[model samples]
Target: MSFRRVIIGLLCLAGLAVVLDFGAAAYSEYRVSRLLRDGSDLGADPEVTFHGFPFVAQALDGQFRDIDIRARAVRPDIPGEILVEAGLIGVHAPLGDLVDGNVRKVPVDEVHALMRIEPVELGRLFKIPDLQVFGPPADKSDGSGGSGGTGVTTSGPIILTGTVSLTSDTNPVPGTSDSGKPVSVLADLRLDADGQIQIVATDIYYGDEATPAAMVPEVNRELVLAKFTRTIDTRDLPFGVRPMKVEASGGQIVVEGVGKNVTIDLDRLQQP
Candidate 1:
């Protein structure tokens, strides 16, 4: 072939390659938006959006937008498997997938709200936001939430070990002196497949207090501590069922992770 003809052919191929690349990216973006929108519809809510992505979703009943989340590696006084960042948003969700008989949902907004509060929020204080969960919510009957037999998988048994250095935004108590030092909190958390969470240790240091201090004083200090560790066990309990019983004594914390005791009523999902 003539040199000129060969050159012209090569240029045509390059142009086609460019078009294909852009086409592939557009397709990927379309697929992601569709999946997110489908998730929102299943949850019975508005829309879902993640930063530059155009689609919006109802993480729960709450609304969120311009969310930019990511996982990264860094060094300093921090150690983490990932770090997530987002613009102004409301109610992201805790990290477990929900499994209820034939139904499963993420409750992303619920998780977000939980993450914003105490103990859970402590992970962010360290700049190491390793807390994350993957996979779509699966049904317990389909048999995919956790291991084979226990029957609870919406909230798997998750164990989190981390250190938190936190400075509260709350005003100082009327009678207490301010140390002006960030407190260090050591935490170990567990959540069963049935959506129950148990907290083993959430030890914190505040001035002279040796044991962990209560985030809320109106609550029984011991119970408050136990609740953070215990109530999580009920987080994924049937939305209407009473939580499994508990007995607390001494300083030790014990809990039964969600098991066959939990039941899911998929019939509640009615179409309007």
Candidate 2:
């Protein structure tokens, strides 16, 4: 081929690459913007801005307001999952009793999370990841909302809630061991007024022989105890100390409030 022809061909290829790059950038921007708009439509007043090719969102509460979530990386056994980092994100309370004044505020900290949603047996999906909360936080003093008034007011203590379908592995860690030894969960969880969350659940799975039939006394008790300990753990700093017991009935488990200053790890309890 002539040298001039070869040079022209290379220039054409370079131009095509540029066009493709621009197209991808534009699409990413659109995706980010769409996500923000959705949050706004859901009553979120968040700030959205593009940082290079990445979209950044800051919500009034540390929730998932103007954030970006990448959908392609969600797959089973595929380690690379989408990372969703949000701020000032709060939970929507359809029930009023949970909040003191019916007012829910988002936490101030940034919630950084690595998550994956997998549809496995029965087309069920599970969310896995470690979420961390950082920054100065508004007080979760009571469930009375922000204003500390009685009834279902807008301002009150904040509680974060999410659904875990039975299909996926929800418990990252087994709450206890067979020999009645205390197993510490390497997880942290907290809820703020803005409706943001930061928590971790690790090492959760059942053994080949592990089944509901075999999960008598030991397994059952551990599961109950785990919930009880978690409720008191978060308020430890403010309340001095709290101890509790957990009971399960029907499909729901209940944690009974213990007296005071005594904290017991349910994994350490023996079946009576």
Name the candidate that leads on TM-score: 1
Winner by lDDT = 1
- Tens digits of per-residue lDDT for model 1, 52-97: 3222223232333433222121212223221211122432332111
Q: Which ten residues in a row have the lowest lDDT in candidate 2?
A: 128-137
Q: What's the lDDT for all of these models?
A: 0.30, 0.27
User: Model 2 misses residue 3 by how many Å?
Assistant: 1.4
Structural similarity to truth (TM-score) of each candidate: 0.30, 0.19
Give lDDT for model 1.
0.30
Please state the error at residue 157 of candidate 2 in Å.
37
> How many clashing residue pairs appear in each of the predictions shown?
19, 37
Residue 148's lDDT within candidate 2 is 18
Q: What residue runs in model 2 are displaced by over 4 Å at the alpha carbon? A: 42-272
Worst 10 residues of 1 by lDDT: 108-117
Per-residue alpha-carbon lDDT of candidate 2 for residues 1-272, written as tens digits (9 for 90 to 100): 69999999999997886676556445544543344434323222223232232111211221223222222222232233322222212222221211122322322122222222121211121131211111111235765333211111121111111222122244422223232222222223333333222233332222221111112234344443233223212112101212132221111111222222232221111111
